[model samples]
Target: MLVIFPACSVFRFQVSQGKIIDPPWRPSIAGMIRRTKATVVPVYFEGMNTLLFGILGILKPRLRMFLLPREIIHQTGKTFKLKIEQPISYENLFEQKLQSDVEIINYLRQRTYHLAHRI
Candidate 1:
């Protein structure tokens, strides 16, 4: 989905819905689950999202360069050691950027909480 912005034409909101597509072949239920086990997280969806977005912010250019259709590429990269040319330095800039991110997260969390519990 695209949302037109009066301020900036480049800014748009795109969202994708979950879908199950038909495959040419079918697998046993157990086999399917086994195949997906490596990617499946039985708990803590919030933490998973935080980790994902944090990595995304740190590596947006590299992320965009090796663009895949879905988030699967990022997940699979984690399983193997990726020898990226300009790997993110978690030493210096990370601390500064991370502080900013933490502030934004806290601000958003507080705003959401207040919105939910508005009197």
Candidate 2:
């Protein structure tokens, strides 16, 4: 099974100041990883907020009232870049000695933001 977890509990836009505003990740994800023995893949998305906001400006109340239309969204001429980093193996987490769910999630959160810095 493939599961995607948003590290943050709430939706936050990427700021222009070049600093990522990362809130504490939900610890349950770490617990899930431990139970499922899932390999953690850190993926960072750049320019998604700009794209969505830009589309919102064009769509206005239509977007606010309804779901985003895929065809219109695809035609926005905005490019969203995704950086997929090396996966963290279940064994790797054990080797790192992350004993608690919080520690594991924090470690994964840091690794994810590290990719943003590279962009």
Candidate 3:
């Protein structure tokens, strides 16, 4: 039950700026979801800015652990939020071939985006 947003969906720079970029997921993840008959549960990671630190780690090519975790602790406050939306059945969603992969992924991204902004 490990749901993963492909790397392309996220922005490396945007994380440092505390922004959630819309995913650019192609048909791959969508196809997998369909084939596996998995329920698409939109999970949003809200109020996290440790990504920038990771970026720094990538840049430095050293002190990876220190920079990443320290940045996370420094940037984040005491409270953070995680939103888990209801499960969306792939079969129900894709009953018809009306929507393209981009369309479906965009809709899911919008859901996560809205959830992230709630705080």
Error of 1 at 68 (Å): 25
For model 1, the stretches where C-alpha displacement exceeds 4 angstroms are: 1-99
Candidate 1 lDDT tens digits, 6-56:
111111112232331112122232233334332211111111223444345
TM-score per candidate, in order?
0.18, 0.66, 0.61
lDDT of the candidates, in the order given: 0.30, 0.69, 0.63
In model 3, pairs of residues that clash are none
Tens digits of per-residue lDDT, candidate 3, 1-119, equal 87686434333344456753443666677767766878788887665446565467447635554555565568554775689877878776686453666666767777666776675
- Residue 27 of model 3 has an lDDT of 66
